[model samples]
Target: MIPTPYPLEEALGIGWYITDTPGTGGVLRKSPEDFAVEEIPLQEPSGSGPYLICRLQKRNWEHQHAMKTIASALGISHRRIAWAGTKDKNAVTSQYISIYGVEEAAVEELRIKDIVVRPVGRNQHPLSLGLLEGNRFAITIRDCTAADTAATVAACTAAAAVGFPNYFGLQRFGVVRPVTHLVGRHILQGDYEAAVMTYVALACPDEDEEVRRIRTEYRETLDAKAAIAALPRHLGFERSLLSRLAEAPEDHAGALKNLPPKLLSMFVSAYQSWLFNRVLSMRLADGVGLDDPVSGDRLLFENGREDLVTETNRRLVSVHLSRGRCAIAVFIPGSEGARIEGKSDERMAMILEEDGITAEDFKRAADFVGLRYNGALRPIAVKSEIQSGVLETDVSLAFTLPPGHYATTVCREFMKADPRAMI
Candidate 1:
């Protein structure tokens, strides 16, 4: 079997590849047009309502930065803008956004380089995260090194028909610095000082050399004022944290609180995601199959209902699975109301025990951050109807996945190269 790159992939708990065929080694996102994403909205906007919905098409723009820029042009708070999902910065993406108390004319008049906004309709309520049905992706992998790209693509496509592990992709953690989970772990442990420091001072080799040097210096000095002056203006979030600490150096928790609530909450959620990845990988290493549920597994139905598999109903569950009724799910632990039964839960508990964390820690983090971590179930595997084409040395793939799934997760199975190349 093809193995994932060491250190980074192994650290993320993505240990193995399902297909044994050689990967069509390639680089992705050579340009913005190479990776395209279009949102499939769940509900269309009505013609008359309080909130004006618009279609946003952007290239080479980070999600939060693009929203903030639009909000500035509209003379409204960035909080007034909402979207169904966050798109990649270095890609051509089209999605819908809702602007509160704005007219179609205002949106039509606004303009920005490499960004287009067109009014779609109006809705009674504003869009919220995960409001879309899913996303459609058209991605091209260029400069492939494989001798027979068609054979490699065919092998991966056939294996993907059964399903692949649903590990959260690299984007969940910061692609450049992969330290969101580290900050999250400190937050859950109630060590706000470490959380703040980790966010501000942790350096990654993938980042610019000057930025890395500055972060390393700050890590050594712990002088927020000096670091604030040294940090570039583009590093706004880091500056915001340091600005707070520069005044009251002991106020680590308060500095963390200065961050947007959604972003702050994401830190803790990333930790939960890391734990889920570990459990999923461990299950795979044990030789568990993804096509059907075995005894002591939790089966998640499409309608959000869950049932446990037992010897009595394993056959029935298998039949329903074949009919696309439900899928095997692994529990993502939370502070409260989380399912703690089944082999998956046992593995999760074992990991938590080894890490010296407990359910109570998550509860405390929720209380501190003013966000709820009530737990949820995620499918262990996901399947898609993939369409692929190979042109000379480049291969293109088109597929749609349910909301909260990552396209890179599918791409990785085909590339089998360094995660950095995919980014």
Candidate 2:
């Protein structure tokens, strides 16, 4: 059994149960010698409509930040720009973006020094939200040590045989006030407090009574009773805050709107939470985690080697992004073969003998909220080492998982980790 120690929120950070299927392959790997040495200059699209485009450097630029820079150069609202996906801030990312209501003549005028206007294409429809199937990451992992090469080969070979989970990256759930971003959005849009509260509730369904009650009644009730009860008596002062907020709805929401754009995005995310949870719950019911597309072993084939085909073996990730189609980089943690099982962290969970919520209830909620959830197995290739010592072993695993699944569930024995999140 998994120890399931950490708060479900924090536990999600360590690993991912791949959530979606790759339109193409999942792992794209190549050695330095195999890497193509040329840069392809993106062609300027001639048509007029909406297009998302960017030529970003390998470092020092977050996705939205880079877009703002490009927008300033072109004299357009940042809101009008769209991207298929976000790239890591530390890597060189040349990706396509969508621009709405821009003229063809203005395309060439938009330029930034290090940023290249990679490619531009017109679409009749603005790219809708969450429209991307997968992100094609073209990355170069540097700072490899002499010892890293052998491990890299082994990891790559393992991936060739097994696939990693397609989990939502760690950054999905923001730190500390995870739902703060969502709350901010709802307040500014003049949304009901209940809607916002529902959003926070979905984030960590298994959150304690104190946390849940405080979040839901944050603007409706304030007496310090709930907060004091939730924590130690010393924290009694926090209870009055919820009542105070209920007294200042217009003022409070207005105050949130006055905050920065990032905060604003988070606020909107909260309003979206109810939907996120509802959908997530429904996807789980369908068993997407143990089913097709996302639940198979994935691999890549060199230009000439095409003997292997997709097959089922127990439960393994089965997908491959072609060599030139996608970039595959393995994230090798400091420890390899580190196993986990049982009570892992700060969060506490008590198995409810009674059904708190049922599958049928989840379906009704999903339809009402418009949220989607898919779980799957998550696998990691690691080299284990005790702190201040050398590695004990290097183990690379190809994980086959269904949607809404986590690979850590398999590593529970070694890491003693748990399924604390997904509440």
Candidate 3:
């Protein structure tokens, strides 16, 4: 296995590549047109219903920001708009969104630059997160340094067919600042002050110099009003937290609570994702094969059923695995009791213990944030049939991934470049 170049990737528990072949060494999303994503809807929109389902197409827009813009044009709260998954801000993406109590005429009349919302049909219920079948991606990797791009592409594609670590991509944590998990760790530890400060004041070199300067100043001074005045208007989330802090300097919990529940919930979820990645890497480091299950391994079926591999059922589990009936899965710890029977779960438990967190901490976070962290199973590895080609010095890849999987995870294997290049 080849190690990743970026320390951030290593810190995030994405330590090694499954294949040791020389990487294509390229950058992704050099332009908005370089990456394209389209959601595969799980259910088609019904002809008639209360919820207006629209196919939203946008270039270079953050998912939440685009939703809010659409809601503002429709004169409704942003919460009224719902989607299955969040798309990257720097890519050209098309996905389905459900708008509550909005008419087709209103949607048609709405116009936003670099955005298009066309009503597909209606649904009886609003779309919720993870409601999609999957997403199809067409990505181009530009300025590749590979001596034989085709050979590298073929080699990576072959390795991917076997399997690759299904680690959560860097984007799960903020690509620019990557502090969501840090804030989450603070939240789980019941340090609301640290959580708020991390979210508001953490600075990254990738950010604009002015933004980084203000964040650094805020971190040093802890002067909420001064920070708020210095922050640009586009940094509304930071300003909102600072606003709450300015009003009540001691109310860190209150300041955190001021954030939208979805965004707030993501912090904890990012922490869970980070834990999963760590455990998955640990399993690989322990010489465990992802394609096969051993005693104490958890088997996740395509039907969403889970079973444990044991001495008694190891052969049967292997048979099922060969038939593509199930895959080895690791549980992302949450408020709900996650059994610590398997090797991966044991690793997770040890990490949690080292972090000084427990089920009670998760429960408290859920209570404080009004979000449930019911743990879920994720596959330890993913396999996809990649379509690849070389265009001059560039390489293009097309593939589809199930909901909750990150394309960047797959891309990382092909281009072992800096994580920031893929951002």
The superposed Cα distance between candidate 1 and the true structure at residue 177, in angstroms, equals 0.8
Give the best candidate by TM-score. Answer: 3
lDDT per residue as tens, model 3, 243-298: 99999999999999887777888899999999998988887777677776778888
Evaluation by TM-score, superior candidate among 1 and 2: 1
**Which residue ranges in model 1 land beyond 4 Å of their true spot?**
none
lDDT score at residue 136, model 1, on the 0-100 scale? 99
What range of 10 consecutive residues in model 2 has the weakest lDDT sum? 344-353
lDDT of each candidate versus the true structure: 0.87, 0.35, 0.89
| CA shift of 182, model 1, Å | 1.4
lDDT of 2 by residue, 319-368 (tens): 33321322121111110111111111001111101223223332333333
- What would the per-residue lDDT of candidate 1 be over residues 162-269, giving only the tens digit for each residue? 788898888888889899988999998889999998999989989999999989999998888889888888777898899899889899999998876777888998
Tell me how far the alpha carbon of residue 303 in candidate 2 is from the true structure, in angstroms, after superposition.
26
Superposed Cα deviation of residue 192, candidate 2 (Å): 9.1
Q: How good is model 2 by TM-score?
A: 0.41
- Model 1's TM-score against the true structure: 0.96
